[model samples]
Target: MFVLTMYVMLLTLDDYKPTYQDRLATPGMMIRPKGNALEISYNSEDTESWDLYVQALDNFLAPYNESQQIMNNKDCTPNTYFIQEDAGEIRNNPKRSCQFNRTVLGNCSGINDRYYGYPDGQPCVLIKLNRVIGMLPGKDDQSPYVTCGAKVNYSQPLVAVKFLNVTYNADINVECKINSLAIANPTSDRDKFAGRVSFKLRINKN
Candidate 1:
């Protein structure tokens, strides 16, 4: 069985108090540049790690945008915001984390989660952010700190996953593993099973 793990770092920024012309400079950019951007990095050892990470990130961010809308009490519907995913693999186990850094336009807060699939067609894993590792920023902090983790029986294979946002950046690294049970009896006519996949996600401000 193949074991996959991933790490991601995210950057959070707030206080986009830019002037009208400054905002006009980039009319359509989703994240306005107003405050310092938080920098987050994720690391993983398994191949296909980045794919899972991106999937979770997409899932997490979609709701985050909505939460922001509710907080602002604006007439806007919570919609998916576009993001760029740039990731790479590290041969050395010591350097197996994905890095996310950006300057956000407004005040936002949230947490991130990691998800992945297991061998033997088991359910997907859902890693929730624990208080120790998944704490968000308080109402009066510089920026919120995101947390991440996994749940064993809450993962599934990537057949046709739906993401709320359009991915502007993405990177994938994958490694395949043979199913020992399937290999043991070639003539058994059992379906071949894929290895496993893992992911990371960040929460949006509330």
Candidate 2:
């Protein structure tokens, strides 16, 4: 029996710094901001279904939740923001809210009367892996062969919120990296193999 091992490394924005333009160049990834929403896309060569990709994205953002239910660990389901592809619109799910302040004035006297906005007002950016292509078996005649492997890294971009009062501002960003892939079929005598590919994302704020 032949054994094939695959290793994936997890990285945050702190590991490496990359410009916004560089991160956008990565394959199978797209980041765009609409009138009031952010859209992130991920493409891959794996055969994983769309549902699986959504699950993976959910897992990736699990730690950023600030809901009371989640903090209590009471089996509370966190909120997920959804974006409609056709209309290019964003809607907050039952657990989440997509509200933002629209008015910002230069004078402090006019805006200082209201209470400070909570950090929760910021919309959570969601990432969805879309499609995968160009995957093939390895060329080696060995009984067990490695298909392919690759690594990608990028910094996370920050979404800024300017307060309508007190000139206060808050910025949030997340960095992501993906690596590792291995495919093998043991019963086949034809010596078939496959290769692996990877992608990384990075975002920054000025």
The TM-scores, one per candidate, come to 0.18, 0.19
lDDT of 2: 0.25
Q: Write down the RMSD of candidate 2 (Cα, Å).
A: 22.7
Worst 10 residues of 1 by lDDT: 25-34
Report model 2's TM-score to 2 decimal places: 0.19
Error of 1 at 132 (Å): 37
Deviation (Å) of 91 in candidate 2? 38
lDDT of 1 by residue, 90-168 (tens): 2222211111221121111112222322111111222222111112212232322212122112111112222223222
